[model samples]
Structure formats: structure tokens, C-alpha cells
Target: METIPSSDFFIQFWGVRGSIPTPGKDTVRYGGNTSCIEMHVGGKRLIFDGGTGLRVLGKSLLKQGPVEAHMFFTHYHWDHIQGVPFFTPAFREGNCFHIHGALPADASSMKQHFCERVLHSNSPVPLEGMHADLNFYELICGETFKLDDITIETRPLNHPNGAMGYRVTWQGHSVFYCTDTEHLPDRLDENVLHLAREAEVLIYDAMYTDEEYSNPKSPKYGWGHSTWQEGVKVAQAAGVKRLAVFHHEPNHSDDFLDNVAIQVQEACPGAFLAHEGMIVSVV
Candidate 1:
């Protein structure tokens, strides 16, 4: 395990889009990749989700030489795990990765799901054939764990097939990653509030605008995504210092997101739209 000096913490967004990868001119500003985030805390390389952005992150890790990483999954949805096969480090002999996630009720283990994802029918390369040393851990929701000097807590989120939210704390600074989740109307989710309470940063799912989420003709109420408006409410209730509006809807273009950012700022002055390649310091 890697250990950084105390109080050193940083987060980088490799992918911010939700549902699927949307590569094209319309999405160039925010990004086309799905949900992947990289956090460096207490000198450890901690990754949240393995979406399409993981491929690019893997290449960057390779350039830095052999590495040992801990990757946590929010769920096993296609967009969240689709980049695993393209993660170059997984094919490298000297690299290693410890995968962690809450297994679904139907899945035997995290390893099984990963193997199934890379099976002959789904991927060109097989998980068994990967050169990197890989390990898997099935995390229980609400459990707390430690990596070096960093502390991590997990909570179940409201989403079809189930998902997890994570809170990471190091040297008193904290960051919460909450995505692919739906929030109930009129009240903040206690589970999410617990993970986000007083944190330095909160990265949340804001996949739709309030208008889109509540559109009578095409409401996305049960679509398992929330809007930035809700995110602001959560941030305010949790007393978070900064809010990162994440999990961008696939069809939302750059202009639309710009408007969303403006709205988010007006609602929550400390909040900003999460975009590919954006870096934030937790302290």
C-alpha cells in the first residue's frame, strides 16, 4: 500500500458522463467518457468506478511505471464496468489492482462479475488471461475500512440493481462520491447525508435538469438519476464545503451543461459542474 504525507489529498475526474460514452463535438467540453474518478489521498492511488475514463487513466498510470491501485465500483452496470477490458494496466505483468465493490444479491462475488464481464462473449480478452495480479473484495454496505492513513466508509444508495456511495477521510479533510443514485422528493436521503456530512467535497449524480426530471410528458422520476437542484439541497443540508455536480446525462450538450453550471452556481455558490480532466484539492 502507498502512503502519502499527512494532509495531502487530491481528486481528478477522468469521466463525468452517465449511462453511456458519448463521444462527439457536442460533448467535447464536458467529456464523453462515463463515471471514473481518481483520488490520491495519504499517498494512495484510490479509484472510484471503472467507466470508460478508466482506459485513459490506465494509460497515464503506465507512463508512471508499475503501480498498485485500489478500484472501488459503485455498481456493475455496463457504463461503470465497460472500461475494464481497455484498462492497459490490467494487461501489464508488473501492475496490480485490488478491486472492491458491494456484490449484488445474485452475484457470488466481485471477482465473478469481473470475470463474466471479460468472458469471451463480452470482451476480446479474458480476465483469466490478464497479466496483472488482481484481487477482489466484496464490501458490505455501511462498513468502514482503512487504506494507509485514509479512512473510508460506504453506504447503499437508491438505484435499480443497487449502488454504493463512498466517503473518504484523510487528515481531517473528506470527500464523498455519490453517483448513479436517485433521491426522494422533498427530503434528503439520510444515507447520502451521512456520507456527505461536513465533508470538504461532495461529488454527486446530477444527470438531469429539474425540468427534464419533472417533465410531465417525459418524466425521469424513477430513472435512478438526480438533478443539480437536488444536489444543492443535499450539499446545503450536509454542510459540505464544495459540491461537484457529476454523472452528466449523455444527451446534454456543452451549451446545456453551461446553463446547468450557471444554475448550480446560483443555487449553491460553492458548487461547480464536474468535467473531464478537472482536478480538485480536498484540503
Candidate 2:
């Protein structure tokens, strides 16, 4: 129901699943690729995460040719960074990409993680094998920086090994991307709420149901995932214009997502499940 100018701002979901890629008949409708999102804001090409979906996005970018873009990673988890080696654009000589994120404890810098992931023992093609002009920036949590015409604000997320949540603003419109985060019971995350405050869209982690998260026999409290219920609460508390529930659980089929959507809509009319190839205008 919300819209942005056709020429300036749009967000597209290339993948929406969490934890793992589950490509099959059951996930076909919503998609099976893990955590990649593309945004075109003020003519800047920005990508979030590099999950398996990035492979598909890379193929599309190849057809366009001579691509230049900035990619922001939430974390270096396998499900989030596994597609880097398969991204065709990274293999192209003329393409340029800047990788941005907070450095993991195990890695000295963002570039180091990229290198290690593509090492001889880990991946067939080493980091040197990629012909693209790649650059990496290690950012601190709670830092504010600029990329082209967009202003980006980063916050630390409550995930193992740490993740960063980003808020990108341009031309008075803002969208917050927060995934792989766990929420504390009965309280909104001050960091997430700060980044999401009054934003046009809040694309958040809704990887579990409240019931599943609270299951006594199998509690997932510290597993670094949040529920749709928590997402709705944050949206309401932050006064977000829309809530795009993202980073779905791998086992949650289309029917399961539909039911979750219904529940979200009933509690907050602006909330909806994020689906692959879905475009959102953030104006």
C-alpha cells in the first residue's frame, strides 16, 4: 500500500529463508535461498548479505555488465556468506564491489574473512582467483557512515559471533535491515528500536513463531532468531510505517508463512511476510 518514486527507491528480496537453503516444491512459492536483499536508492546499487540468493543476483548483474556495487554483510555465518564464491560478478574482471561489515572475532578484518572462506581447503577458487576489484571495510557497531548519497547507521545485533543491523536513508526516506537477531522477552531492543524509529520500512528477523521460541522442551531463546510477534512489537514501538517480516525459518512452508502473515496483519496492518522477488517501494 506504500510507494516510492519509480526511479529512485526500491527494495527487492532475492532470498528470504534463514539458517539454510531449502530449494524444493514446498518452498518454491516463498523461495528457498537464504538472506539476500537488493536495494536501489538514489541510483546507488546496494546489496545486503550474500547468501545463496546472491548467485542468482550475480547472474542478473552479469547480463547488465560492468557492475559497481556495495555489499553489506550482517555477519559471516555460513548461511549468510556461502554464496560469495559462486557469485558470477565477483569472477568478472570489470566488476567492482565494496564489502562492508563489522569484523568477526575470529577474523582480523572483513577482507580476512573473505580470504579465509575462499581458501584452497575451503573453496575451489581462492580469493586471488576472483578478478573483480573488491574492497572490504570493517565498521564498528553504532557507527554512522555514508555511501554515495545514502547515509547508513549501524547497530550491533544479538547474534552469536555478532551481526550488524543497518539503517539506510536517502531523500528523507529510510529503511532498516535487521536480521539474525534475538529479542529479549518483554522488552524491545533499544538498538534495533533506535535504528528502526519512524523508518518507512523495517525488514526484520522473524525466523520463529512465539510458540516455537518459547517451547520449554526445545527453547531457542539464544539461537539468534526472533519471532513475528517480537517483530510486530518492535514495529509498533518504533512507529515504523511498514514491517517486512524476513529471514524465514527454512522449514516454514508457504502455507505456514501464509498463516503467519494473517496473524501479523491482524496485530499490525502494515506487517507482511517478505517473499523472494517481491519489490518494496520505500517512500
Model 2 TM-score relative to the real fold: 0.95
**How close is every model to the real structure, measured as TM-score?**
0.95, 0.95
Candidate 2 lDDT, tens digit per residue, 1-283? 1233485888988889999999998998889999899999888899999898898888878779699999999887888877888898898898999988787667877777678753325776778778999998988889999976799999999998789999999988999999989998767899999999999999999999999999999999889999999999999999999999999998899999999999999999978899888888886
Give the range of the ten consecutive residues with the poorest summed lDDT in model 1. Answer: 1-10
The C-alpha stretches of model 1 lying farther than 4 A from their native spots are: 1-7, 118-120
Q: In angstroms, what RMSD does candidate 2 have relative to the true structure?
A: 2.3
lDDT of each: 0.89, 0.88
Return the number of clashes found in candidate 1: 2
Query: Candidate 1 on 137-236: residue-level lDDT in tens?
Result: 9899999999878899999999988899999999888999999889998688999999999999999998988889999999998889998888998999
lDDT of 2 at 14: 87
In candidate 1, residue 133 scores what lDDT?
94
